[model samples]
Target: MKGISILGATGSIGTQTLDVVRNSNDDFKLIGVTANSSVDKMKEIIKEFNPKYIGMMDADSAIKIKEFCLENNFKVQVYSGMEGLIKISTLDEIDIVVTSVVGMIGLKPTIAAIEAKKDIALANKETLVVAGELVMRKAREEGVRILPVDSEHGAIFQALQGNEIKDLKKIILTASGGPFRGKSKDFIKNVTLEEALNHPNWSMGSKITIDSATLMNKGLEVIEAHWLFDCNYESIQVLVHPQSIIHSMVEYRDASIIAQIGSPDMRLPIQYALNYPKRKEKVAKEIDFYEITSLTFEKPDIDTFKCLRLAFDAGKKGGLMPTVLNGANEVAVSLFLNKKIKFLDIADIIEDAMTIFEEYTHNDITIDNIIELDEKVRKYVINKKG
Candidate 1:
């Protein structure tokens, strides 16, 4: 059985990961878990999983869970904040660390985990988007396996099972077109937060749902795929597939295309990452093609969703530019979620931040450099006028 630690055990991906572990039937053990301010959810997880280590981003929540564990006679170590995250991530007992946290918060612990020689099941795209070079290098040095847990990246990974990377042509990432797939700029500008959060195919966290509405999520994935696959930005392609059945595709130089098609469930990818190089009994439901009518595709309307265009631009520029883009988008999405800015303003803010930090495009990508730039971009976005 493989030992596992989930860094964000209360989030959507984290909870689903817990489900995978729970049903693994002695194939896996939950060694540690962390969460941000989800005291109730954390308590429930502690009761069930009884992981050896627990980390809470919120100190008070950590205290509460600790007290509950003590009263319940559960022998578990509870910690708080980044320090806690790192400790749990690098625990010697865990063979693999699942970096499933949202935003840039997942980067540090993921790096720490790699340094500790732990394999990574990466669901956090921002970790790669912000510091792909450094993270991938560390993984290589540690001889660690960085598994892709995102559906698109997972699909590409599956399709390339027996194929050689040298024969690869490009990767095709599928997007759900969100709720405003064909809507004009005018329509999107006036779209309410509720509408943006109302995704057609996937049930995700609010932040990601908003990113999907803006198409920035797919753009971020493009940057991530570049790092994970060791492919250039020019070789990555994004298509609008409303059905989401085709999670993603990879094409070879021989003009042959391989695809991983499945229902839009995150568990399949999560379980696949956990049990790498091996296929187990399925957790997600099988796709019934007889009931399905048709699968369709279109070119992503980058003109309408400027965030996607900005992501490609930032990714192509390389270096710390993608860091600036991700930092700005996190703050921008938060602003939109709070009803403080129009949905369109997100791209404007990210683009402006990217332009402001363009001179640092070729700078060295240290963890310190990325964190400093991220802080600067967040402050800039928070203070900028819409």
Candidate 2:
């Protein structure tokens, strides 16, 4: 059995990943699990999986969990903070490290896992959005397998299985377009956080939900597609597919398109990544032909959801521009979620920060440089609200 570790055990993807693991118990083992501050949820996961180690980004939460473990005589090691996360990520028993944490926090642990010779099942888009160059290079150097856990990426990966890289023409990344897909700018202007967080197809965390509403999630996925598939920015295209039945597709030079169609469930992708080079029993429902009348696709309106356009611009520029875009968007989304900024202002803030960083910090592409730039961009965006 291949041992696996989950870095964001309490998260949406993390929880679903566990379900996949549970169903595939004969082939996989849960070696570790982690979360930020979800003590109760973490506790439940710990009891169920009985992982060897657990880490919490929140120090106090780790302490509470450790105390609970000690009192209950549960055999587990609890670690806290970034260093703890790195340690858990590098555990010898874990052959696969599922990086499910939402943002930049997942990057380092993922890199650590790669260095330790653990294959990565990557769900966090920010890890690629910020440091795709460095992360991809490191994975290549270590001969690590960086599997895509996101549904669209996973679909593209599956479609390219038997095909030659040279035969690939383009990747067709699909988006559900969120709950506000058909709404115009004026309609979106007054949209509340509730509406933005209410994703139409996928149940995700608040940050990703907001990103989907703004179409920035698709943008980051495009950048990620560039890194993962070694495709040109021009070749990775995003289409608004409202049905989300076709997770994603790839067009070949031979004029044939291969698509991975399934129910809009994250677990399918997670299971696919977990069992590489092998197809397992299905965890999600298969698409019902009778219930699905038709699948519709449309061009994403860059004018309305300008964050998508900004992401393309940044991805096209390369270097630290994508990092700046991601960092700034994280801050902007945080501000909007806190009711400190308007819904439409999210794109404006990201655009402004991207322009500034592209003009100034575009020269640095090193991991350290990107991390530093990430912090500065976040601070600049946050401090500007004053």
The lowest-lDDT stretch of 10 consecutive residues in candidate 2 is 355-364
Give me the overall lDDT of model 1.
0.93
Query: Per-residue lDDT of 41-85 in model 1, one digit per residue for the tens?
Result: 988998887889999999998899889998999999999999999
Give one digit per residue, the lDDT tens place, for model 2 in 1-386: 99889989889999999899889957998998889999999989878878889899999999999998999889999999998789988999889999999988988898899999999999999999888988899999999999999999999999999889999999999999888887899999999888788887888999999999999999999999999999998888899999999999999998899999999999999999999989899999987899988999999999999899999999998878988899999999999999999899999999888777776566768878888899999889989962
Q: All predictions: root-mean-square deviation over Cα?
A: 0.9, 0.9
Q: What C-alpha lDDT values do all the predictions have? A: 0.93, 0.91
**Candidate 2: lDDT over CA atoms?**
0.91
The TM-score between candidate 2 and the true structure equals: 0.98
For model 1, the stretches where C-alpha displacement exceeds 4 angstroms are none
Residue 376 lDDT (model 2):
90
